[model samples]
Target: MDKIHLKGCRFYGYHGAFVEEQTLGQIFVIDCTLLVDLEKAAQSDDLVDTVHYGLVFETIKKQVEQHKYKLIERLAGAICQDIFQEFPAVQAITIKISKQNPPINGHYDAVGIELERQRP
Candidate 1:
């Protein structure tokens, strides 16, 4: 299938296992790979033939900024579910969520999780 890559989506959210994290919040970077068929869009050359990436970004932004969860996993799941519901042409999605500064005692880059899901 074809792909639509939405990368480097950053948002400020209160999602973490620690109370301070939920209180102070932090930055979360998300990348999404949407598996879709581009044949219709290629032929029609119309916005309606494909998913509106702007709207999709807004959907993701809403999920990230408006809600609070204890885990990024749950946030990822919510994003996938909303995307699937909002965009019928999307067949599958691969999402990566990274926390900029996690409450860990070590020197390293961002840490997070990636999840891939298909329409149910």
Candidate 2:
């Protein structure tokens, strides 16, 4: 199947176990790959025929910003579920949510969670 990819979307969210983390918030990067049939959209050249990526991005961004979750895995799962619920055209989705420059003692750039889901 064909796919539409949204890569490296950055957002600030309150999602961590630490007290300072929840109050201060941190930067999170999200990457999504949506699997769908693009032949119709390609042939017709119609925006309606394909998923509106901007809308999807906005939805994800809004949710991430508004909701406070302790784990990236939960956030990613919720996002995947929302996509499948909101858009029937999406056959499958893989999402990666990363926390950039987490507050850790050791040297590490980021930590993240990745999940893949399919519409039933």
Candidate 3:
């Protein structure tokens, strides 16, 4: 299957387990890989033949910025669900969400989780 890679999508959201995190909010970085067949799109050379990444970005933005979740796992799930629902051309998705400064007492670049989901 062909792939569409949308990486380094950053958003400010209030999603965390801690009170300070939900109150102050933080930056969340997302990387998404959309699995789809691009043969028709390649032949047609038309935007309609493939998924509109700009709209996909908007969908992700709404989920990240407008809603609050206690866990990044749930957030990841929501994103996958929305993407699959909004785009029928997408067969599967792999999403990674990173929290830059998680409320943890440790020295790390970032803490994150990755999820892969397929259409049923």
Candidate 4:
């Protein structure tokens, strides 16, 4: 299947189990791959036949900003659901949510979760 990929989309938000982490916030990077048919868009050369990347980006951003989750896993799942519901043409999606410089024991730049989902 063909997909439109949005890689390394970054945002600063409050999300964590720790109080400092939530209050201070941190950088989050999201990467998404959306699977959909492109035949109609390709053949007709019409924007409507294809996914609107801007709209998708905004939707993701809006959700991320509105809600805070302790787990990146949950965030990614929510995003997947939002995308699937908002855009029925999408047959599948892969989402990765990352937190930079998390307060871990060792030196680690980031931690993340990746999830893949398909239309039912």
What do the candidate models score in CA lDDT, each in turn?
Answer: 0.97, 0.90, 0.96, 0.87
TM-scores, each model vs. reference:
0.98, 0.96, 0.98, 0.94
Q: How accurate is candidate 1 locally (lDDT)?
A: 0.97
Question: Using alpha carbons, what is the TM-score of model 1?
Answer: 0.98
For candidate 2, what is the TM-score? 0.96
Model 4, global lDDT? 0.87
lDDT of 3 by residue, 1-120 (tens): 999999999999999999999999999999999999999999999999999999999999999999999999999999999999999999999999999999999899999999999987
lDDT (10s digit) by residue, model 2, range 57-78:
9879977999988778888888
Q: Give the alpha carbon lDDT tens digit for every residue of 1-120 in model 1.
A: 999999999999999999999999999999999999999999999999998899999999999999999999999999999999999999999999999799999998899999999999
lDDT of 3 at 81: 94
Report how far off residue 103 is in candidate 4 (Å).
Answer: 0.7
TM-score of 4: 0.94
- Check candidate 3 and list the clashing pairs: none
| All models, RMSD in angstroms | 0.5, 0.9, 0.5, 1.1
In candidate 1, what residue range of length 10 has the lowest lDDT sum? 100-109
Instruction: Count residue pairs with overlapping backbones in model 4.
Output: 0
